[model samples]
Target: MSAAADPAAATGPRALAHPGREEIRIEDVLHALADPVRLRIVRRLSGAGEGQACSRFDLPVSKSTSTHHFRVLRESGVIHQIYRGTAKVSCLRQEDLDALFPGLLDSVLRAADHQARRLGEDGHVQRTDG
Candidate 1:
């Protein structure tokens, strides 16, 4: 294993790649958001006003699987990830998404919340009244 072959040796531990706002496609965003794991990641990021580190998520999937999900989100332009110190932090590309597709992000998030409550997923308490 040569140092040149190692990306960390060249750049950093992890070289995060994210799609530019202009490159973001609705199809790509929808495709990335369709997955349960990815949706959970987005939902959490939405609630978090500030960026969250990759280590903060206690997902049911394995570490590698979690990494894959994050990659999908970043590549689709649904999220922007950066290396903050040694930790890679992520946050939703809400402003960019909104600018490109008006109300799309909020609608998807609302729909996700409604579905979660409806199906009692993710500890979302289903209401019986009203």
Candidate 2:
């Protein structure tokens, strides 16, 4: 089987590249999270609190586009990706980020959640915040 087809082979250290905690830069993280799709991914990962397979997300974008978003997040150190039985699973780098930025991730997620609640998923105003 191809490497991608064999999770065992793909689980090696070189399977994916992620910046170290010290290497993660605030600007890169912010840029990665700036995209709506990537931010949505992060929000879901935050809520899951566990590794989520890439295919599990119901992203509106095409598969290639979603992959690109994931790459951006991973490269920027906002998330970590690993292969699990022929599936790429992703989890937020919450601990690393918290240690490095001290509440930066939580703040962004909270603000995003509040905005989503206020605007609804369609981006149209649903209700005004009291």
Candidate 3:
């Protein structure tokens, strides 16, 4: 075999990667949720118990941008992606997240909702719970 024909050289050794039980670090998850678009995506996702299709979610962004956001979510382990026919379905990694950080996702989503309400009210809301 010619030196240039070596498959190993074409594709280096496969780096160690998690199969299905991949653990997403807290920092990565937080970073993923930090973006407004991604946060909104997550909020809509967590609101529904069932997996949502890529096109079903109403995002105020272009299709390419939406696809990029979804990719980040999936890479950060905040969401799971599975091919459903020709469409891609995404759902929150609930069990994995719960096992890693209890109540983290819930609190973040609640905080986001609270913030949105505050913004909607022109930064005025009766301070009830912190």
RMSD per model, one decimal: 7.1, 5.6, 10.0
| lDDT tens digits by residue: candidate 1, 27-128 | 999999999889999999999997899999999999999999999998898987877788888888888888889999899999998888787855666768
Q: Which pairs of residues collide in candidate 1?
A: none
What count of clashes does model 1 give? 0
Tens digits of per-residue lDDT for model 2, 14-128: 5887776779899999999899999999999999968899999999999999999999998998888888768999988888888889989999999999999988878999855
Worst 10 residues of 1 by lDDT: 1-10
Whole-model lDDT per candidate = 0.83, 0.86, 0.75
C-alpha root-mean-square deviation, candidate 1: 7.1
Q: How big is the RMSD of model 2?
A: 5.6
Which predicted model would earn the best TM-score?
2
Q: Estimate each model's TM-score.
A: 0.82, 0.87, 0.75
Model 2: pairs clashing at backbone N, Cα or C within 3 Å? none
Greater TM-score among 2 and 3 belongs to: 2
Tell me the spans in candidate 3 whose CA falls farther than 4 Å from its real position: 1-22, 121-130
Q: List candidate 2 stretches off by more than 4 Å.
A: 1-14, 127-130
The digit string of per-residue lDDT tens for model 3 on 1-130 reads 3212224423434311221334578888999899988998899888888789989988889999999899888778788766656777777777777767899998999999989987673546656586
